[model samples]
Target: MYAAARSMSRRVAAAIAVFVVYLSLAPPVFPFGAVVVHRAAAQELDDEGEFSYRRDAGNGPARWGVIRREWSACAYGHLQSPIGLSDTVAGLADRPGRLGRTYRPAAASLVNRGHDIMVRFNTDAGGVLVDGVAYRLRQMHWHAPSEHAINGRRYDLELHMLHQSADGNKYAVVAQLYRIGRRRDRTISRIEEYIERIAKRKDHEELIDEVVDPRRPVRGSTIYYKYTGSFTTPPCTEGVTWLVAQKVRRVRRRQVRLLRNAVHDGARRNARPLQEANGRGIGFYYTSPAHGMVATGG
Candidate 1:
């Protein structure tokens, strides 16, 4: 009896050792943290959900509404993201109410979000001023094949720089669209270079050097499309103020490829289909003389 008891003890010890090894070898799964701010706010965004791009098993955008009780807006909301920018909409001048940006270079980190690659910027990197309210820069992410269309045209890429107001209740997005061309836009190239460095990582993230400037893409553009929309991801929270740059830039095909390689299940193409306007009027903000005198009202 004593010999049998000792043998069982040895077996239990071996099993415990194996379990510890397994735990150590497991890959870490990180929830999109800190940048999301309030715990309830993050939960409202479904920050911990396994939001996927696959459409085969009801995992795509169309099915998001039924996936969770809070995500009903994904299917039910009228105001949604990636809407088409129309020229017929009345133009608004970037005059007395022009957007004011004081963004500067700061330490940033890149994360492989499984759904997309998100880069979070330091809040100290002064954000944009919209309608006299200051919205600090939070993070930026990319969508392939352009989410928002320009005059019914979809470009090769789209970058959404998200910002939050002082109260954190209000949100604004600054979108920059890109097309494939020969011009090597320095800002985009540098960002793509960093993305390439972390492309192979899955559910992993790496902090990049402070060489990237968050203001580079918006440096030259004064024309933009402003309107109200919802978050493209789950919960599809509406009332988001969107400002899409009318001045499109060029990006190398290879750079777009880096974005493609970084995502999972060959779901690199992360853009949502253009949503219905639902009687929403669009406003154009431009200083270009070619667009005639920019009017104030929609």
Candidate 2:
């Protein structure tokens, strides 16, 4: 009887040890490898708007301008959408049969400020005439080091110009890729000059005199790869139309260096990684003329 009791106690101890090991090795129940899950939680706990580190208070007006006057009661929404192209491959066949054949470009619009960089635009607001149909511009923003890979290649920067319609339905985007080259962008030039002046003053109130023309000459074919994706940031809202422009714009190496020098989390990088395409179809639009319209996509 004594021997049997001793053996049973030993087995119980061994079982407990095995159970502890299993708990340690198991993946997190909520989100083992979800990047969005972690970011959302961090954003929620971060009060005092510390997550908006880019909006530096010490740098004063020079760095971010007069906040009270410029920003005003703009609804400080926590659910700001992220910008990216989708790659999911399901339910693609159910899309409108005119998916590739129908083209619209009339919807495009540009805004000078709000989030990152100096200017932002929404394509949904502006309509572009493409093959006669008016496609509205949705939204626009930048991604450092680019996002879409061309034959496994990346560029210095990329601009996503998303577009939709007047009825707040349907979606499209114009993507303009940029690289460091000899020819400079006039719009970028104006922004750089202003930034330099701001850096010199450091803490002075000044009305920005530079005017940035959103329209610029683009090289390469107007061919584009289209897909449906979600915002690249928190909330991870889905159903964003993506249009990555085939052509690439050129900016001087020094200009890129300037952007790299800006203070972001005491570092100079502000970009998100490419999300899973998840088997989404990427449509190619070639042979289309450079259509003019205002749109915003970020």
Candidate 3:
């Protein structure tokens, strides 16, 4: 019996050591020293456990930069996101342009990451061509009460369709805002079943195993706003290409409520506060009006 117990203890220690090394060996999304990348020296440090969206919380957005040394951009970066968008201040360019998109159904999974709910793609879901570069779709997430406001009007919900280049350096996000209406969003209706399964569980993942179409939010959109912004969440990585749809979709109030309740109490109203514009361009890509995508510049 003693020999058996000793052998089990030795195996447990070895397993623990292996797990520790695996975590330490993981590299940050942004590398340091002898590396080069166009997107500034910032990385998305998204440890939601260290932050919150509650107004009364101490670790709120106002103090995210001070919470960690790597999250300095959340407070001091000039090119932050979640800004107010308005064409009254946008500088339009008279040039016909189009973004290439070839999206297909792909396997995906849903997870409640404490701060919010996310749908992560497990296989290649096609991509969009921006400036001749292909940015593959990676994941999609939602924020309650929307994030970016249009013409000084905020909506009831916002969806972020995140994509990145093949090298994992460049990022482009397609944002779709929604208002509370009698109709239901088709994409949300499909995944609502899984979302309910993990509604009360934190850090829980449910294998959807089915292909979740990422193009539903982008369909029937003739007008969109293109701008350059950063991640609205932690670490706040800048230099991200933003394409916000002008066509605001209608979503049921209950759908938005489910998304809010799926996360912890601290993140129920998870939209970040509006940041300063800081003299950046906001462009509009529309089929009518003038031409293709209108340019955006403060």
Predicted structure with the largest lDDT when compared to the true one = 3
Query: After superposing candidate 1, which stretches have Cα over 4 Å from the reference?
Result: 1-49, 55-57, 92-97, 286-298
Query: Candidate 2 or 3, higher TM-score?
Result: 3
lDDT tens digits by residue: candidate 3, 24-107: 998655664336442222232233457899766657889787767788999999988999987665445444345677888999
Computed on alpha carbons, the lDDT of every model, listed in order, comes to 0.78, 0.47, 0.84
**Candidate 2's residue-wise lDDT over 1-298, tens digit each?**
9999999999999999999999999977767558777666545534323223233433221222223333321223222122243223212323211222222222222222212343333222333443334565444555566756655567887675555665666555566778889987665566665555433222322344433334442334355555666554333345656556656778777766655554343224444444445455655444332221111110
What would the per-residue lDDT of candidate 1 be over residues 165-276, giving only the tens digit for each residue?
9998999999999999987667656667667767767667777766468878787787778888999988899999888988899988987877888887546778877889
Model 1 poorest 10 in a row by lDDT = 289-298
Task: List TM-scores for all candidates, in order.
Answer: 0.76, 0.53, 0.79
* Rank order (by TM-score, best first): 3, 1, 2
For candidate 1, the per-residue lDDT at 43 reads 64
List the candidate 2 regions with Cα displacement exceeding 4 Å. Answer: 1-115, 120-126, 129-135, 169-171, 196-212, 217-221, 287-298
